[model samples]
Target: MRYSDCGGLLKISFLGKPRIEFNQQDITKEFGSKAIALLCLLMINRNGYCNREKILAYLWPNSNDKSAKYNLRFNLWTIKKNVGLDGNGNEFLCVDRERCSINKDYEYQCDIALIKDLLDDNIDDLEDLETMRHFFNGELLEGYYFKECNEFNEVIIYERNLFEVAKVKLLLRLAKQYENRGDLDSCLNTLEETVKFAPYDEDIVLKIMEIYELQDKNSLAVIYYNTYKNRLVNLLGTQPSKKLTAKFYELSKRPSKGVKLGKTDFDTNNKQRICIKTKCINGIKYFWMASVIKSLLEVEGLQLEDYLTDTQLRDLSYIQPDIANSLGETSARTEVPDVRIAVAFVKLIEKISDSIRLKIIILAENEMDDFSRSLYEYLQDMRLHVDLISE
Candidate 1:
């Protein structure tokens, strides 16, 4: 993976092995434990030079002699061997007698690299904010919580906290867009993730309550509403706003005018038949397709196992009208299957009619192997609408 900053970019690669290839073709390798320690020290000093004596003292405090130099030399040589040379045939991690610096010629793409950028609001590079979110796995070098690395660890932690703040802001923006479009499911998912980052935001909590009401989920709506009201009263010494109180009263007085209420037969079963299949798992495609179906179309009692058959592929299937209606469909009808081999899942999206859509989620990892892609392309040529979802 690649990350960048103002001074330069940090590049990391994992092929047969893991290595950091710096700008000057300076390489850090995983040759042994000692080598790893050396690399970590260099990373900690990414912005400046670390004198040889200081490096040696950091790694081996008591010892001072040819043995220590020899150990450092061996690891350095390993690092050079692993990372290729730079444009001028110079190694990136280098020492000229006494001083050494991680070369700034090459771009650096560390998670920390983007932190400073985010703070700068360099509008030219604002698009990189999203890239910043992916680099943070946890507290920087979480396992190496030594006192010597504490300062460096603090920098990483501070940067990660900033990225999280940015992520929550981004999610809120997306949630608003989804809400305006009346896509309650997508809106709720976005806000729910947002809550994980900023749970104390009453505005977000209110949005969640509104979405629940829109979905006619009054029970869930009531719970969050009460929680919101209680929090305001206990923490701020005030009740829920008049607007919010009135909304709760209106919602509690009558049945939810929820869209598509009596649409699916399984509404009471807790397992609604979103779709009807002539058979189940009739073929390999059918078997894998079952997984995606279960994930996308959720009816309380509906399941794929009931319709799968022994054949690898099949002819027709059906869905309960009510379940289809919940997903913006008006009716149901039997039709030919629509299958696609995705990177990770087998997707079957069928149109019950012109307006109704049926989607099946199938879990199949690496279904897009070299050969599979060619076959998939042929299937596409035949007008089969197969898509890939890696997650």
Candidate 2:
């Protein structure tokens, strides 16, 4: 059943600091710590009766049977008195001399119970996953401690782990949904929200880096990678996996010290690089840096090797990775401004069009990008028949 307190029935929040609200009133302060803990116990075992002997052992293990039973009776009374009944006048707790339980038929909303129900399986509904995220304000029963019940605390720890995993699962699913919708900003935010909870999860970290790379936020990717790597080193006394490290290397790439001739020459293997650094290209000054960038990337014979990340190649499974290298062909990595690839792509299109007539149609010509505009102008130079249709 969907979690709700529509009828103002007993509602308990066991995820964070234990809270009880009946009829929309905060009655949590009226109950003692033991009483709240007892409510949590009953809620955990809501599906079936908790044996009276087991309850006594968990909550009052040190007390003799007489005192233990007395304590249990008093706590139960506190619960029943505060929780009272639902709208239909049905009691919310099932109490007997032999056992105790939360009435299964009771109309109520409990945060922990809701988490279990929602996380019973993988969730696809974004609303349900987001709703589950709101309940994890803190750990299970954050303010309560039952020093006398080691077993109960152990149970708390176990449940806490399960709740944590489910929370991460929903968060990941939510991120994927956002990503699929092309709301990358929202997707990135959702993933970051989960880092506070699952810092050690390499998969989450890997995903975060992938989004950063996709967004061309290489600096942020490096920052996040260093932060995570340092965290692992300090907290877990370990290092990131090779894949993660390789991602970092890919994102953290920079020009190594080499020759700085007034030309764009990049030879990584020989550690040689030539840059015009200033707002100029090949000793020609430009009033704007944009002009310099344009000139830099337009150099003759400037062939750049652009390698795809595994994620980018995820959909292109048929394109075997490093196929040329496997066949003893040299492959190189190139930095941004992969205009060389664009020039080559346009050339390939021109070559293909030589044998077969090709008509290029562009939508929203007003919003045409620089690359497309350049390609269009280049095609015009080739005297290719062109037509513009506009309303």
Candidate 3:
């Protein structure tokens, strides 16, 4: 269902799964990948032209056996039919012999762009941000991975990263809102939830940890630090920054009534192991790869049950993390991940540390963005210090 955003407001969501929820509404209807891709492409090139060739290049790049044109027409017809624009010739999908573009005259507002604008303006009103967030339900057509769909992959990744930044910004905004409302519990809860969704986000996690520490919830802070530390190491093959480690170290040295979970650190002696598999069919390559690294450094003989699934996709890739500690990378490079590497990564990390471990699987071939890269390094360093501990 489409919501008119002529002026009221548009909230955008591109998180776990892709859906577009109207303002103040939790109800969301699923959208097909084709439709979502079309919308996203149009929104990206909103003021520009997106002809049939562009759509075909993105949606059906591999089909060339004489029926490619037919397939293209069929797909476009399918999209237009679903949008209910063809019957009335509303110009939603304009085709002019050799060119096509989304009708520019219609009143359309992109939730993604609208939300960014609000944040950029630094609007202090919680209601306003919440109103914007109402439009978000999930990621941009999530879980619709296809090897012959680079255009889709690229666009979705771009939006996913943007959405992530928005999520963090929203959390900060919400935290401030709750704090102002004199609801420390709600404020803390919002930060905690934000941490779960973005475990690699240390700044937010640190903020939450600091709040907890200030509130004398040292145990909670310790728990979060340990969990976040493990998550970083397993995914990015690095450790936490010196500043974060110092905080955790300072906290550890403090007297506490909290139960110690396990060894706080994990080793990083083993090199990160990565295996990639690729297949090319009809000039389109399907790529898949898996990377395994250390989890935590200090615990002895502790094992975490494998919990892996696709959570976030950025830069033509989706990330699968094992429970909370290790990370696995899987991409359109291959439809299937290298399970052997995943299993090995888990086994190695489990036996080595009591701290949280992460197994990450990402679907993209390139390095992660700067934000994710920093997180990976911080976690890895945390694991190193843990491993150096002599029990």
Candidate 4:
């Protein structure tokens, strides 16, 4: 059967929401709910055709055959009235006494069809990849429901699940491409979205943690590790793989002391010094330095409460600028020292411990910026023992 002899284009959108347009005008409302359901039924079937008897029974199962046939006729009339007619006054549906189907010759666009085409095509460009992603705005006819149409609902659910899986796979493919290009930020952003689709996928969680570590954001790496561990334990009654757990432990370890202070033989009063140096320090680095200090003090059996004030501990938990902005802020100060605060707390630890040892560990060989360079110069003038690590 031919339904497009009128030479105008028909568009049906069934992804996320369902709508029908003809010549760029919305004609979906012109048909009743039953009529739209009938169109969907025919569209979903491979042949785009259904016998009149089967269509009537599926749509109006409680009605007698005669009553159901009458309702089907009314629905068909409504559908043809809005969709069949073209600008030249031609029809798009091929109807007869035995069967109804969209005209095989009719030109049309459908989101489901688009998805199939995308799946089959060799996608080579970002524009096409983005376009394919757009087709899955949400589940099929997400909020549209017919109270008694069980068959239609079944088709909707099956198609929604199928498309959701396809969307996730596509996202993973795209994210891998970003990772391959060393675009860590974009790779991370994409994976964050992918996690929403497959929240329990430990592989995705591990990839995110790995990215955080590569960025030198050990604090975030630890946070994601704990979050995923808890999710797995709570939801699945199991723990993450030992390999992942071991990696987490490795990342959480205190930074190795690379510099050695001279022998403690000269000090008679039992006084000691502690120093930390980094060419560039952001919020993550600052927090990591604090963690290392805490771990060192714990190893020495020092009581944290006795050494650092509550305010100092609070400052150690200061929020990173990116995190603060993500939480939405009206005004936030940027004057907080990215490295000096860490130094101040180390000094506090020194003051509280007479037998402490001073050792400076520098993470970067070259200063990152002007401010960090100045800090490095100041530390140099102090003649502190500095150990610079090669990045």
Top candidate when judged by TM-score against the true structure: 2
Off by over 4 Å in 1: 1-10, 13-41, 51-74, 87-90, 94-99, 108-111, 114-119, 122-127, 137-139, 142-191, 197-391
State the local distance difference test value for candidate 4. 0.62
User: Each model's TM-score, in the order given?
Assistant: 0.42, 0.62, 0.52, 0.58
Candidate lDDT scores, in order, read 0.50, 0.65, 0.52, 0.62
**Which segments of model 3 are wrong by more than 4 Å?**
1-36, 64-95, 108-124, 230-239, 249-391
In order of lDDT, best first, we have 2, 4, 3, 1
- Cα RMSD, model 3: 15.8
What tens-digit string does per-residue lDDT give for candidate 4 at 1-391?
1112222567887787678898788987887778877887777663567888888767887788789889998988888777755555556788899988877566677777656656657443554555666677887777878788777677778877887887877777777777778988888888888888898888888888888888776545665676577567767999999778888777766343332232111123322333444334452344434433443443321334444554454444352333233234444344556564655555454543433454545555443444434444555565443333334
Off by over 4 Å in 2: 1-8, 253-391
Instruction: Please identify which of the two predictions, 1 or 3, would achieve the higher lDDT against the true structure.
Output: 3
* Prediction RMSDs, each to the true structure: 15.3, 18.3, 15.8, 13.5
Clashes of each: 49, 0, 49, 5
Q: Write the candidate numbers in order of decreasing TM-score.
A: 2, 4, 3, 1
| Cα distance off (Å), candidate 3, residue 277 | 51
TM-score of 2: 0.62
Residues 195-290, candidate 2: write the lDDT tens digits.
878988899999998997787665456556766775687679999999999998786674334433233222354222223322212332112223
- Candidate 4 lands at a TM-score of 0.58
Compare the candidates by lDDT and give the number of the best one. 2
Residue clash pairs of candidate 4: 1-104, 2-103, 3-92, 3-103, 4-106
Per-residue error (Å), model 1, residue 312: 38
